[model samples]
Target: MKYTVKGTQEEGVQACAKHFIGNEQETQRSNVIYPDGTEVAAISSNIDDRTLHELYLPPFADAVKAGVATVMCGYNRLNQTYTCQNSKLLNGILKEELGFLGYVVSDFYATHDGVPAIEAGLDMNMPGPWDSMTAAMTYLGGNNASLWGQNLTTSVGNGSLSEERLDDMIRRIMTPYFHLGQNEGFPSVDPSGYFITAVTAGYIQTSRGAPPARDVRGDHAKLIRRIGAEATVLLKNVNSTLPLKTPLSIGVFGNDAGLPADGMYVLGDDPPYPGVPRSGYEMGTLSVGGGSGSGRSTYVVSPLNALMARAKNFGGRVQYILDNALIAKGDFSTLYPTPEVCLVFLKTWCGEGTDRASFENDWNSTLVVERVASHCPNTVVVTHSAGVNTMPWAENENVTAILAAHYPGQESGNSIVDVLFGDINPSGRLPYTIPRREADYALPITNMTGDQSRNASAWQSDFTEGLYIDYRHFDAMNITPLYDFGYGLSYTTFEIVGTPSADLLQKELPPFPPSSQVEPGGIPGSGMKCSKSRLSSVTQDQSPAQLLCSST
Candidate 1:
């Protein structure tokens, strides 16, 4: 990929990794959310050994480790931190820690955090979305980007940037752009040449591979099935009554139930495919997958649209509401309209770059489920999200199932519906834990703060739970999550029973005792969600809720 960057530089085009440090999902990202180190330990706290090393920081680390000429900062904060201005993230981590040589780029309309960012070490702002940049510059009164301009002038005058640190920063930033010929000589155009279609098969071969269905699309389709399968997490299965066999009339519905891949958010470049919707925008202008820190796009793939297309194999059974109205406000009864082994397609959207506060913004879906559960006793809920969200209707007995597809990429829509309808069994687990309530945030106060940030050591003492991170401490400590880590459901039940076998393999998962869970009141469902409201925002402020499990 760095080679591609070098090639882009050769062509003299600005190549940007918009929104650095993985700020992909979450609406109203501008408003910060100080995730308690306790709640978002996967990405926030230094827990989960694997996540700490590979999952969360590896990509950026790899890019910089490979020398991505430039990086864009994001709008949201990470674990009570604004990613843009946190110098620890910027100078300390990216440059100093990971040895990043490139300059920092800010996302559209994300410059509001510029002052702190500059102090921390951000270098550029773009498109001037709000166009308040000029005003900001003047307001700087020579206090640019935490004195970026002033710092440079001072540093150069005093010979700081000339020093090794500044020299390194300069090389990182200028190389790629310079290679693009923006900063230097004519970038290597030989690497930037497109096959001119006629110039290729006219210039190259029959543009196909792998024999039989050798088209590139076929290979990609195969890969999507694999990745999407791994990314599909099974949320819950109560009585172990899952992995359903025998052909059953499983109702399918959702804003995304019937659609094909649009590849709108595919990282870097993924071209249009046969049967895929063509974007109204030019291919060059079509920004697929990257952080909002990259830029904005007028296109997206509707899960309903893809679900409809993918469900064609099931025939007349796959019914769509077609009303085109998002059930953002009304109940499913009002919108879903029909009722057979139902799958309600709930589509949520507040805007281009933002978030919806509650897990359920309205009683709409729950109300819909309440109404439809009687109509079709079997129902499953599937969610497509960019980040972890609060699930308001999680405990409804009528709601039989749930699956979380985190922006499952291009083929997500089709893959999700397939899993829910039994075409596939979900195996993916939550990448991060799902908190029961919005207020469960480790630090609710962080998001409200403006651009200025002072608490560098805040997370050290502030993470709420000192060491209970991710599933390790939390689950072991009896901290009940809305959904536990490693929580995934499948259609079939396979009990892991054993009598102390000596030979164990990876596939042979170790068995645990089939302990009976005795509920305190001696009643089955009384205390399950009864204590839900007990975790209100007010309560969260005064005291973090302890997981209280009692014997029946």
Candidate 2:
């Protein structure tokens, strides 16, 4: 939060802390009524006060204390009231207890009632006037009415809302602009070509003629490549199979090794039915997940492209088969032909609108890996996924290595090759526990009850698991995970050589510091400071840490 606020505001851009409270699930996330007269109420996260404070509220509090310019209330209800208009959450906890000075904004079309929303301390209703139908057909275009523009004026005229409260809202909204020094020379707003392209498919032109083409990409590719390489977790390397030595013959398999055959810009495809080939959208090298959060790349270098380039440089033979069916059906002797190494790329498709039905990879990715590994002696499997993927073939003897290359952006191919060929050491760690079974999770995604064909009205998700989630749940229940969180591998190793020691300083910590005037970055100098009082000795022959500690 501090980094984002400081960085963005330094460039005259206000940072927004979003989905403010409990918004755990994506199912039934918005208020909408189907054409068949079925109305779906946003799921209410029924969190107890203690659990709310301990688990969900602290992150938001930290964001507020960082002096975030804006906070976007979520789509879900908090204890049965819509978060956009929840009085206790917005006014009581956020503004009063936390002492947040920024304005509260609602998620896109999340606000239901105008009066209740403002009275509950909602300062902004995003995208103005929007109904359920308009929200549902957002891409296709529909009604565009302001929910608060006239309604707010009318409310204040009738004395339903006080003028002072209206002024307070304006003051809150404008405070960040001046606080961030946006009144000084900031870059002029340009027509968003990306947005125009998405909505109108390049059919609509901006009123200012053509959107000015500017290349703001300043060494971002280099940073992205470095991050990608560093984040590639080496899950398995039985015989030091990775850091490839420019083998004479290499065979690459699976759709994930190349770009999607159909196209690159497809978004949001239905999960393929049994026996149907997975759509190009799902099968291709998944640099990013689907839905709103996904970004468009200027160009993507596929694993095939990167490997071919590398092989060309080394005068090596490169062969690849991107079709999943061909790999499943082909004879190993004819297809692979005694290749020195076989690389299998696989991915799981996950995004914003829905939850994954299972932990297994889509389109029988495991079967592909198992099939290839069975034929080839030196098979390396690379997986691109958003989260925990059940690797049934982790124990397979034929599989020599495994790389969890989670959703690396445009530099996906180069990054993987860098790690594979020993150009960069893999140090990425798993952020989530890989459970042996889907049932091992503390809670399964709540399914719609009452009817299968229509949306359910009583769509309430109970937080019965409390704080026992992810690795915490596994620890509490004594359920051994397939791969525990923070599990990662490196080409080299290190050993702790000495006992850690810390300088002792005893002082009674106060419950609260003396109250002060709240600034944009919260109370000045309130952020916790870390002193270099602890030390530990470590030994490593050749590692990143050794380079840093060499001078010491």
The most accurate candidate by lDDT is 2
The top-ranked prediction according to TM-score is 2
- Expressed as tens digits, the lDDT of each residue in 1-552 for candidate 1 is 455555554456655554555463442345333655322211222233234344456557756655467878876565556666767778886778787666887765455543445567777655343433443443334223433445455766775454555565566667766555564454344321232221221333343531232122445655675567556777866554333332224455433444323333322211111222221211211112332222222233345545455545555334444222333333455434354456655433222433344455222445554444545566666655545667767787767766666555455555665664456656566656777766554433224233333233332212344324454444535656797644655554433333312333345433642233322332122111111111111233323233222111
The TM-score that candidate 1 achieves is 0.52
Off by over 4 Å in 2: 1-10, 36-38, 132-143, 194-213, 270-280, 449-456, 497-552
Model 2: how far is 486 from its true place, Å?
Answer: 1.8
lDDT of each: 0.48, 0.76
Clashes of 2: 2
Q: What TM-score fits each model? A: 0.52, 0.83
For candidate 2, lDDT tens digit of each residue in 220-272? 99888878988888889997887799898999998899975545444554221
Tell how far residue 320 is off in model 1, in angstroms.
Answer: 4.1
Off by over 4 Å in 1: 1-94, 97-166, 174-226, 237-316, 320-340, 350-355, 361-363, 390-397, 421-424, 435-477, 491-552
Q: For model 2, what is the error of residue 249's alpha carbon versus the real structure, in angstroms, after optimal superposition?
A: 1.8
Worst 10 residues of 2 by lDDT: 543-552
lDDT of 2 at 438: 79
